[model samples]
Target: MKLSKGANAPVPTSLLAVVVSWRSEHAVDAHALLLEGSGTVRSDRDLVFYNAPRHVSQAVTLDQEPAPRTARLSVSLPRTEADVDRIVVAGSVENGTFGDITGLTLTVHAVDGAVATFEIEDADAVRALMFGEFYRRDGRWRFRAVGQGWASGLAGLVTEFGVQVDDPADPARTTHPTDPFRLHRSARTSPSQEVRSARSATGAQPDPAPPGLRDRHDLAPVRHFPHGSFASDPPRRSAQSAREDGATGLTSDDVVVQRFSSSDDDADGRTGQEAAHNRSDASASVRPRTDLLDRAETAATLGSYRPVDLTRHTSETAPAAPPPPPNPDLADWHSDPEAPERLRWWDGTEWTSATCQHHPPSNRHCARCGHPLRRKLLGGLAPCQRCELEIEEYLTHWHTQAWRVLTTHGPRGPVWAALWASLRYQRIDADAGRRALRAVALSYVERLVTFTFADGEVQHAELELFEQAVTELALGGPLIEDLRRRMHRGRTLSRLRAGDLPVVRTPGLHLDPEEKVHVDLPATHVRQLARGPKLTEGRLIGSNKKLRFVGAGAGTEMPWSRIISVHAEQETVVIAATSSRGGGTFAVADPDYVAAALEGALRVAKRLVLTPGQRDTRSIPQEVKAEVWQRDGGKCVECGDGHYLEFDHVIPLSRGGATSATNLQILCRSCNRAKGARI
Candidate 1:
């Protein structure tokens, strides 16, 4: 059988079996009497063994001569590690179910020879059985039954007998008595009395009585015949008066008897008898002439108890009493130092219960009322369970943004920014902040398009791809709508950024806005010069200023920030295009230093240059001028007057003279296209 979690070790031969076909007051009395008389009863009622086929062992012989033909098996609740009892069976047998013996009866016998039989039909019915072995110890009886497991058995048995399990511990019990006639009908037939008599005749006259019951004459007081034995011509008026004579012996009639042994005075000779009489008289004179019952009544009346001399008694609080034993179930987890506190309970196999020495929280009282709340209720957070859930959600969102920000701006910068934003005093409008976050992302996309490739040439296709990536990264619009109707019920995360955005980490580009000219090379590092201006400064016209470059020379400050461009074709080196603080731009190509510094294949250095097609001033092209004049009407030959049009060239060539209307400039076809195709 599987043991319960934290039970004591196995004790040896402490359990006794008292098989009864019924559970009545008489049966209970008989069981208790047997246990008490034997004086070998275990405190836990491990002695009261169940007779079911499952719990009980098979028949085993106690002695060899004239075999008893009775089962005598002993089992113990383990008291120590070495005390476990192994169950053994003598013959082939199947285990018994609880249902097999639910309809039993018990008998309870009072000390006064009054028997009260109770049926096994409810928890109340089995209450006596559950407390089956109260031994008469030191003149006072105490309960000696196993308390926990029997409740289940009792409940199940009562269910079989059509009753519910109720709290029998309640003092207010009103259980109906079982039908006496029906109970008698259901009682199992005991071995016939004639057969017992025959067995007694055949076997060694069954040891006349149980042990410690010898001294037959001393069992009770001597009767009336004992009074005549004094050769009494003078009849005694009272038993006490007869006892006063020297020859008349005292009996239970004169003595207040008890379960505990009490001493008595016996008459020996005339001298001894006189002395005994003298002693009795002196004892009576020392106290009062009151009956023992009167003393008991007086003690009760005075609300006094017999002074308990507890020196000889074993106290429940003695030092030798074992510490609450460990429970066996948590043995494995208790061995680990890092085991959770709640998981650390008493494990019988190991000491795992940790002392929680941490100071408790401050929220000691309930918010709704002033009553003191349990520590666990307020130990973690207000609305503790719900608060934990909220924290988890908050952490999820924080981590999601953390990964993205770290990848883009690196750990230190992004982490500091996040910390600052979180701690700042300014009010954060979450909705508008989210919109501005979109603009920030788009600005980075625009900046990345300005980067030149390794060949020092920028591709419009790359720019288009960058734009597509930005569009793809945007919150889903049409695609999510299509997916909603086709694949899912509806789009839950409509605001979620798209995952299709490509991660492009082009080298030789200023990936971060704050820092500049970050080149991972060996010796000759090229960074924007700190003493120079940024590329954003400076007019289109050139002044006398020389371009700043990141070179090893005596400069006021290091020009590491003045990295305007880079060149890696045939050489892994960076070129400075602009500098911080309005410094000029310059290229970096120290062959010995650059070659020694640069590692890896010099595929091509990416450059950052102005877009060649973009100009500071705007002007109309020749095609746009032609199209405008044609769309507007031809002008008059005299004034070259045309509605919102300029003079245009015609087929009349200036090389060969041919006076045609197209050759003349008439503004708005008014001057025969004046000043157009003229010689």
Candidate 2:
């Protein structure tokens, strides 16, 4: 297998794309490129030579020798100097070959007998051909999986190498593995302390703190920076007088960071045989810049492992502390008003509980909690500890409307179908959306339903859906009364199909009017309705007493106004709205939408009552104020101010906040903070 060219050899102006076909069972087929030269190839036959140097080599390596195989060839015409600079060799598992590629290695030799070898992963060896140096060592090769650094080599070759192997493999070829290249070591003048900031505060860098320095909780010991105390220090380069003379320029913590390496053939190393197996530690040189072991160790620490304290000198490290208890404030935000607690905040660099003196302490209350005093106690998103009963209730309501429109009329079930189509374009997958607790199909419908609500103008025809749905409800009958003015009447650019149901929006809405009006809406309330030419796959439902609409097309009949008070109690939200003309009470399912709608309706009410005369009239009877106070549990909404309170509309009535007890709230002096009279 001595493939070579001499001093008088023709300069290859094009690259040779080689593809080997083989079969294997027990052993995987592999290949490697051992040379670089310019030439062009086409399939298993055509070959064209051009004017370029050489610069490509790849190997299809295997656990055992490759099975009987044929090589396919292709040529890439030279375009720049890189094409003439080096050579390239690529390997592949021949067509109809058997078994997987278990391992691979490549070896390249120059005219002057300069040889370079590399053991690469079976799949990536040939791809690694882009890097000129490719060779095998000792006849045995160990393949390793690719990591982040491999992508760097690809960029360098295409941009820096100028040589492009344009003939990519056919449909079935496997992807290339990463190439592991050695990074040149940086020069060290004199070693300095690598200290954590805590020790840096003092005048000088503190000596390396021994391991277990803060072992006991009661010890209250201090730790200095430059942690490698046990390691030896580098020699100083001083020349002047004793004090100003030949002063050892090296600081007390100055130490030459060195790595211990063992020769490949050496059997006298600390871990001897075990160390020999790892190629990274097989460097013979002790030179600070030439040692691969040191580079490998540094890379290993930064690339994969967490920062570790390796100093063997024992001084007793502090015991890890138990996590803090969950904050009660966050419990109210979750579906369940009374869920178990979780861990609180930790501002440490690595959750080590070691605080930085310069940084402010984390707030005690949970950050995500609506309670100004409470925060999201846990680190990130905690698992679903509470039941999704509220979400399910909302979904139930959405489902009723979804099922009605999906099964009832039109050519394409309901709005859910269009939504699924839009989500597909958004690149949203079921797994990702579900993880975020979003229903893809439902989101499509909701977007179409609410686009024109908050914003004054409707940007698209979808606004008609929200307008139509809202019209069926009595409370804000005039809210969406002008459907034509809000929407652009465009052609049917998109429609939901029957088979596309899985990808389309599914609507759900729940209406409970017992103690209070509770509106439960499906979680898919946010995805876009349509994108480019695709319709999104989710829907939203606005549930008021009179109307329960799904998408822009469907609705469910419910006595929503007959609702009384709606509040979260434990796992369920109770709604106490009256039915049969305020005679008997109907305790329907949970309604999450009611709160949000109340917020929306209040905004409308506030706008309605914003007249100058309305401000001084004091139309809110004293009796109404008393009821509102009791409903709020006599708590302030601002500053947490408790006394000298007044009745305020949660959603100001002028903006559509109702005169109902549920819409009004009690606010103390501090609670009203800057909430001036809007009317």
Candidate 3:
């Protein structure tokens, strides 16, 4: 079994061998500290090392010998004192830091020959590391992979756990290493070092090999609990008891160390050793016959959890809580620090079935509606669940996201120019920015090209893969088009953006000068305003100046000023105009966008009347920008990207939208430019 850092598995038995191996020319000393329940050692007597290789209780022993690159320790848990709850395994190198040595590994071999291994992946420049521990939890002993290090070496490590450091009385002690984990040794100090037969003549390792060392070898994957799973197992039976019970060749080590998710209080309000005993009897009654298969268990016993390894980022306002004890505060919900996107409810004393959808997948949050996606809606350019209107419908949502991204990435200008500025910001020279953007673009293209499967329908995952891709790469145009088509949903995103605008021209329409079309919903059906029962098949055509429903006959057209507010339904829009006007209820393909387009066109008509010569000015009020920044979480409104931000007028100002906070939304240059990409 391979254990990841911070992961734990129960040891079937206490009598086990732990070996620390690394490929280094320098000798690395291994030490074990027997810790009490209070987390401190009883005294220097509990320390096991080269000089003091055996514990007073006869429960633990340092092998004092190694197989080439490995050091071993034998632990007999049954012989350990009840007061001693944990055995901490640690190692150190006095010659240099662990970073200088590679391939550091810890292997635990149980009496049943079950093996669990952990490799320290991130070896820092620290002198010592608390590799892991075999600790008692609810009467069960489990092994945890703890790769924490100490920069101050073993002295600081021992002192932290209440060990006193004193100068040795013997003169040779002065020459010997003082750090508990790093017992100093050298060939120059020993007179017979040359003829010591390759043994650690420095006395760290025994010259003669230890017994039982020859039996250890590669073993099969132990039939154990699954990773990050909860299991049910009783208090471990002794090796003698298992043999007498005739349960195959299983020993006390044959039992798996298991953890429960809840307290006994949730049952009959039990506590202390009484709680443990009662639970043991209760679980033993349900324990299945293991003799049915000595090699593997038919199924996993069900129950709960173990130690938590939390690594998550919390909101800026409230820092994450420290790793809590087995039971902290009783009630309410707390973040699952390991899985950031989940909330685990603490029902006063134990975990309950209470849960809710947790935080979003990204670190960013949306400003206007407090969406977890920040400006990016559902990891796409689509409208947020709350704010369903397109950019043109509402214009007060982009300032803060824009300013933040703009300043960090250089400046906000044209869509592609802004992203270029952000990507190339602070580059060494003029060509640096271009090279950087091209690199990103190439990487994006490369990923899609490598995936051979190209079914016509695009999966959400595929679209998200290129949701932030640089769409304007001239050299990648042809391939990007093919990839875009493969990933696009129903229609191209460029069409969606165009559909959100204040104008969408129908191909065959002959329009008058300045009579711009805003929206065109095809395959639409209509009903008359005069309470006519018959339905008419038509296309709903919306322009900046009017709303028209064209069918087989002369189409009905009404000026925007005469129409009342548009009501949007699932797949239809209700256009209520004056009794004399031609507007009517129309069933359309996308009523939301159609309704929003009509509303936008009406606003444009009103704006044109109010300011006939008004031109688009790319400026937002500072106060409004500040409010927008706070609301949109200071990131792009479409996607929470914080670089090269531009205040994307959801509805452009040229279409008669106001420069208001409600209409402002920040979008990164990449997202803003991706609006026109085919995908």
Candidate 4:
């Protein structure tokens, strides 16, 4: 519908299109100012859109429609943006007043069709014209033909809308040439004049000047004087007249004035001497003081003096203050008065009714073997240094033996070893722990080993008989009934070895069942040592006093009396012995177990004596064997056979050669015999 000035129409949709067509005689620019619900612009929300240096909004955008005399503004109506509530469409003449524009029309269209239109006919003296506005009322939108005009141009409208205008003449005022929204001071008025005009427009009176200060416009003009210019010369008088006046002591009005001029000079050019003579004459005119005694008497009469007493004052001394008493509430642990050997606990505010008997401090020693603990084991209840190294060697041997038994004799060997060690060291009920071990071993066999129909699936009775046989061979059970009861549960052996499942403890195993066991057998010891990622899982088993390690796909063993030196290296323990050619090194997961085992092994090894034959036997140690095996790739060096290995002396013992690792090498039995025959 065509809308004239002051006309209005209801808008249906949130999205609306505004088209402005103006046929102006001069260049004119169309613009719009987005305002809030207050019908006013705020610094944070107000946005100005113009032709040059165009401004775009997320909710309202200017379309690139190809209409020569037209500008299109697309408004997104259903806007969640809380800041924009109204859009004011306006136009301004670039170089001429709005009166110079002929036909100016602004039309708003909804999706259906034309919603409203504003037309301006006479805009004389107006440089900016607000054509129409689209605003929100309640929950609905409406369009109004405002047709408001400002004679002071777009800048005036911008200032009226609360934008600050910078003085155009201010050199310090920064403005971007392409910024159309920047308001510039009007050329007709300076900043001060504009301020005055604003005050006048607001009906605010200027403050009155302070009293006695003339008005700025009413002040007299100051006169300027050139250099060496004089308004009038001083009143001329003769020096003789001045001297006569001085002799007569003339009155102030009759006194002669002497003038000194820069131009004064004698004909003989003696200006300096003349100046000196004049100064002397001036000095001679002053009267001299003749009464010295009279001057002294006058000074004495003017001066006042008084005598002060020179004696000291006396006063009595004050008494000293008393010291503070000791605190009664403070408490500390002290020897018991009744029993000097006992200590009594004392709470800070008062003493508690608790007393503890003190035990004499003993030299730290291995709890298991009673070997004197070294400085390295002094931290806690760790075993002596020897035990630590022995434990590592024992663990290595146990892991290898366990894996070998598991692969060769079936899981029964390792499972029996684990169960027996658990019973002996963990102090668990023999019958119950055996039952748990049997169940675990059965699970392990089922999971790891597959039996075929041809392999002879045994009946329950036969299976029980087989279990009895394994138990008798690996773990000595007294009778069949005891073996049956012990190996009946059929549980997984891995979980039992891992200690995730606990076995029933023997009754009266300790005074407190909850108390931790100080000494553990090889199985529990290795399990404790294999606690970290470096050592995944290991079992230490001891049979006939020989420790073996079974895990990590390798086995290691060392007699209890063979460890010479046991010490820790980073996270591992290294074991060296008088009998071994090289030391044994194993990763340490549980330092306590390593220390305990090493100390015990060392104590045993130190006390035990070997027969002269055993001691002097010219045999290569396991460490040297390992080195030779690796060096020879587990093959005979002479014949290159990978089996029937024998460590032969490179130089025969009869040839005065030392039985050392340097003289040792691996050879097949045939090669060794041939070499012996040749020697």
Instruction: Write one digit per residue (lDDT tens) for candidate 3, span 248-306.
Output: 11111111110111121123221111111112222222232222111111111100112
Poorest 10 consecutive residues by lDDT, candidate 2: 492-501
- Measured by TM-score, how close is model 2 to the native structure? 0.18
Ranking by TM-score: 3, 4, 2, 1
Listed per candidate, the RMSD to the true structure in angstroms reads: 43.4, 28.3, 29.9, 48.3
Cα deviation at 461, candidate 4, in Å, is 82
User: What lDDT would candidate 4 get against the real structure?
Assistant: 0.43
Give one digit per residue, the lDDT tens place, for model 2 in 1-679. 2222211122222333333333332322222222223322111101111111121211122222223443332333332211122223332222222223333333332334413333343333222223122222222221211211122323222323222233333454322211011122232311122223335655554433322211122222222221111123223321112112212111111112111111211222211111111011102111112222223323322221111121122236544544322332111111111212322112111121111111122354222211123224775443221113222332333334433332222113112332222222111233432333223223333323322222122222334444433332211323233333323321111110000011112233233542222233442212223563322222223222242324344323334444444333222323334542322211223322233343233223233213211222224544565465445554565555543455555675446766556666656534543564343
Model 4 TM-score relative to the real fold: 0.26
lDDT of each: 0.26, 0.27, 0.50, 0.43
Q: Is candidate 1 or candidate 3 better by TM-score?
A: 3
State every prediction's TM-score relative to the real structure: 0.12, 0.18, 0.26, 0.26
Where does model 1 exceed 4 Å of error?
1-383, 393-566, 570-679
TM-score of model 1 (CA atoms): 0.12
Q: Write the per-residue lDDT of candidate 1 for residues 1-679, one digit (tens) a residue.
A: 1112222221122333322233222212111111212232111111112212221111211211211222222222221111112221111112232223344432222334313232334333232233233232222222222312233333332232222234546565333211100011111332123224545777833222111111323232222212112222333333344334323322111111110111122221111111111122212212211122222222212211111111212356433522333433211212224423222223222232221111123476432112343444646534433222322333334334533442243222212233223211111223333343454344333223212111112234334344444543353455334322322211111101111111223355323353322122223332355886423221111101121222344222222233333223233233434534333232234332332222111111222112323311122243443343344433334454322223333443325533333442324323432443454
Q: Rank the candidates by lDDT, best first.
A: 3, 4, 2, 1
Question: Which is the better candidate, 2 or 3, if ranked by TM-score?
Answer: 3
Compare the candidates by lDDT and give the number of the best one: 3
Candidate 2: which stretches are off by over 4 Å?
A: 1-19, 22-65, 69-186, 189-191, 195-198, 201-205, 208-499, 502-679
